[model samples]
Target: MTPDDQPFRPISVFTDIAIEARDIVRGDAHQEIPGVRVEEHQARGVRVTEVEIFEESAERLMGKPRGHYITLDVPTFKERDPELRQRLTGMLTDQLKTVIPQDPQKSILVVGLGNWNATPDALGPRVVDRILVTRHLNQIVPEDLRDRMRAVAAVAPGVLGTTGIETLDMIRGIVDQTRPDVVVAIDALAARNLDRLLGSVQIADTGIHPGSGVGNRRQGLTETSLGVPVIAIGVCTVVQSISIAQEAVQLLVEELAEDVTLYKILREMTPAEQRGLVEEVLGSRFQDLMVTPKEIDVLIDDMADVLAEALNRALQPQLDRQEWT
Candidate 1:
């Protein structure tokens, strides 16, 4: 197909460190990423009202030392392709160099928090694939030894599938054995917008929940759970089926609004015809939304690299100072 006739590519917009509830709507309304639209009001007329839980819990959970949160908003999924992910990962490493404490002895627990079997919930495994694992690196001698000074481990506690084992149980087991100074949990998260897929990466000091992907709620990995700092890195990957339909409808409306002929045709068509058209446009393909799994693998791989770099930066200084004591 010619360039114009080709399918619309996914767009992304990356914002700086500042995150307010307001940016949520602004990002959508401004089309911060081209080609996609975010409708502010919902169909039932109930608007989204965000409650700031952080302000309330700051006093309760604020005392613990943990990694800082950084958000990178890419304008399009295509822009964050595999190659871009790799470059970004390196940039993230540089950025981390600037942020993390330079502690040579500091041991960190890099927790990959998702099941390996599921594609949508595979962020943990994908990230762990790119990290510098200490155990493996320790096997080599001095000259050939990789970066083995920093402590790192990958864990994916199967949700419910582990039978009666709780997430905390697994974390506690690891902490008891490894005694890492900090823990970083990477997992997939749910986003209200379908456009967020493979584009937005959120870094938070707060811990994460493992299988919240398909709506299975569980306790989170928190300082209280493990008596250690926890960092969460995630990208929102899934969109509700209804939300996909609504987005398709919104795109259709925008197209009809600009083209008078199309508008007239849509207006004249029966409800049944409109339903058929929408169904045809949105089928099983939409179900496997977000970028292709291959694309997601690229995104996750890059995301992991960026986070690893950031962690290295954050930890290296502290490590150098021999502060793990």
Candidate 2:
């Protein structure tokens, strides 16, 4: 069928990664964006990008609230490389330290946000299991070591589908009781590109929208919503199926461009038109489909361990490197 005869309908790609949404429209990450600042750094085997969106205009453009986003791109984070894993964990720890408050007496609550039943969505609960909770341990540890420990607590409130309660509400109840100095949330995220899935970790001061990647938009776990600062850490674990298909269409268009008739017809369609055509071809059944890697089982475990270690190291800087305590 000619590109002209295809019916057009607008479609939107859902992504929880701050950089993915911004880069889509900005064309280049290095280019100046109004009300937004972009900085890039590389260390060891990881590539780090910091994007700060402080202006309302930029917030509207990026579809993210005014906050700081730090993304670590480590292609092998999901792989079994002990030395590299240690380095990445340290890097994640360093990045996390910058946002957390400097108060020595500070207490923190770490909320893992996802359904434990689902592996792709299980990243949160899995990481929570490994976090070092010192809130109750300070009394038991030797008196000399007590001062180095920070009160830490973690919970993995099952998703609404399972618990019949809002994740935010459950968290709110906990926050009211504990009144921690800060909150850290971990969840799986969706990315526009499959390459980023399980490869990038995004740390944001903007909190997080549970299930946003899957169109389940739950209440955001943010400062305004919970009355405490929230830090969200997520790894891209899925991609919208439509995003992959749309990119495939673009590649096909380029491949077939030598044919003048086809080239003329296809070139006339705007990017949105191409996306619409892709959406139509996808139909309703595939509209809600989200794709994840085949090796997600192993990947999630590897990543969860590293991230849990990073959280432990960051929240308790004085802990021995070899010990999570």
* Model 1: lDDT of residue 248: 61
Error of 2 at 208 (Å): 1.0
Candidate with top lDDT is 2
Clashes of 2: 0
| TM-score computed on alpha carbons, candidate 2 | 0.89
Off by over 4 Å in 2: 1-11, 27-31, 254-273, 322-325
lDDT of 2 by residue, 18-44 (tens): 777677646423465678788898998
Give, for candidate 1, the lowest lDDT window spanning 10 residues. 42-51
- Per-candidate TM-score against the hidden true structure: 0.61, 0.89
For residues 41-84, write the lDDT of model 1, one tens digit per residue.
22121121211223322212222123345545553544656555
Name the lDDT value of residue 97 in candidate 2: 94
What total of clashing residue pairs does each candidate reach?
29, 0
Error of 1 at 194 (Å): 3.2
On TM-score, the candidate that comes out on top is 2
